[model samples]
Target chain A: MSNPESFRELCRKEIHTGPTSGVLPGYIQANLLILPKCVAESFEDLCTRNPVACPILSKTEGRPQFLRNHASLIKQGTFDIRTDFPRYNVYSRGKLVQQKNNCVNEWSSDHVGFLIGCSFTFEHALEKAGLVPKNVLYNKNVSMFRTTKFLDSAGIFHQCPYVVSMRPYKLTEVEIVREITRKFKKTHGEPLDWGYDGAKRLGI
Target chain B: MSNPESFRELCRKEIHTGPTSGVLPGYIQANLLILPKCVAESFEDLCTRNPVACPILSKTEGRPQFLRNHASLIKQGTFDIRTDFPRYNVYSRGKLVQQKNNCVNEWSSDHVGFLIGCSFTFEHALEKAGLVPKNVLYNKNVSMFRTTKFLDSAGIFHQCPYVVSMRPYKLTEVEIVREITRKFKKTHGEPLDWGYDGAKRLGI
Candidate 1:
């Protein structure tokens, strides 16, 4: 993978459409959600109420363009959101309709976009602490489960079950994992649980 | 000054339009902004770029009803946004148009609202520390100055001067004030600078 900027450029041109794993090693990658203005408020509320599941990276109201440069770049209108991401999961009225390479055709004047913090950021920190994240070792996407734990409902997003990504670790390492991830409050801070009974508590 | 719920009820009934100072003591009060979905993204970007000037408490996509309870309430479709605020400053194309006790008429389906952290939260900490915030001492609104500091431009909010609310303190108490305020990162965190030269440096 090239530098983040060049990687984004390639994505902008539709040359890359796969998972962004191991790309831009030290830089952050985010989960994307775009919705109509009518439902944007509910989504924002959902993120706020469930900070651990939906830690926000950045959000845009109705603009289709995004900033490619780091937060320090003062100038406006840097990147086009329509074609920048590797892939987008498109939903309509709370149903997954399709996954698209780019959302250019789906973009609308009333659409709002959110960049949510992915757990991948803290996974890097775990590796540095001499702890191997299970997913990385397995060479698979992180295991995600829909838990019976209900998210605090926001406007249109009522009573939705909380979704959590899972990674297994030895019982002895649980405290250390919690300590390291807790420091990143913005990136789904800390593990929800560690062992088999822990998973049972979440109803996974 | 009553419990936050009752105070909100009074505001909803159009009885309380005064400054929220000393009302619902120990409960948080917020700075409110309501904008059409058109400018919402720019404002979100503006907040992201200049977090110190605008630490957001909660934002809604297009829902007019704010949470009557604190952020913990999850059930949807709660308070109405129109008559809930003690006051609202209306803006058209980035210009202040009117300050209204209620914005029921001005709010459209296309509008989004933001609850931003007010410096008042830290003022309590200041008072507890034996350092009286200048505004509270003078029995006036906090002194706000437009600085030469430029906020990073977002979509429609371009090259806007950063606005800071000020409270003067003795040189000896500067570090103490900073230490106390730094804990409230969600609110405007700490003094950007202290002393007469500090104000001059910000081009206030």
Candidate 2:
């Protein structure tokens, strides 16, 4: 569990089938998305425009001859998209259809994969900065809420609201929090807005 | 040529099937994209993040049981995505398979559509401001070039470069051009950077 490569091997063999979060400390954990290439353009564009919300770390090569399953190189070793994830949620028409441990059946020549940056990376930095957010200190999941402030719509991803991961911090520590987070652009950098006015602006 | 409604009608009837650009002056023109809903999330995410290059104006509603063909209400009247575009290019695995006048044979219930903001809308405003871009003044198509500045990759749309539309302007007219485009947020607000230094920064 200490070594990410060995952990990934365990994931491939289905021996360690649980949430990968908090397991790989000191290493960057990525959020993965696998979908068909046809609809990927718009998604990539949206992520590029909204980096704070959706920062991309790595992605699979867009090749026409996706004849074979891809073995993506993460940090230490190659990880197959279909089998590497602890679990997979199959969404159909924006609804969850099924849950699977692996996606060997679902992944195809047309499918593409992306590795999005996780906020956990910055949380590590925040802890180092001594401005640890309330949720982290409490060892609780950062409370998330759907705000009225909608993101720019693209294709069928319309009416997509800005989902905020709330982590309360002292008023005195806000500037330090901003400074620490501002350094990590790939991770959600800096507070978009702070305080009650900020909350109102975000429509939280 | 004047009324957008009549123009759409002409497109539907296959009477005036040509480029829709420069025809409907003073009207907001949009770029269209149609794809399956299953892969739309990533595409939409990419578009949302990179608004300047990909300004999304409107989108089809994401719904389950997409049983029938959708007749979308555009600026003036209901225009079907299949027949309204004047032309359609069928791409499979990122390769052009064929060209069609309509997508009636191709479009299915799983497909989703998006209307992206076109630069032509701002061109109209720019002309009104008495500072026409070089492409418009000489009646030439805006020469667009791909820059080395890649966007934040999402899903399969990785290694996507920033394709810039080049237009020449005098040094004195730069700030005014910036001011003119600044007001149009939905249509690429202001210059990301300007001049040779700007071009260098964008990696042009």
What CAPRI class is candidate 2?
A: incorrect
DockQ of each: 0.02, 0.09
When only the first chain is scored, the TM-scores of the models are 0.90, 0.82
Tens digits of lDDT, candidate 1, A1-204: 567667877888779888665566566778887778998876876676456678777876445664323345423443667777888888886798998878889988888888888888788788889887877776668888997555534555655766888888889998788778766667676676658866776666
Cα shift from native, residue B107, model 1 (Å):
49
lDDT of 2 at A134: 69
lDDT of 2: 0.67
What is the Å distance of residue A6 in model 1 from its true position? 1.4
True contacts kept of each: 0.00, 0.20
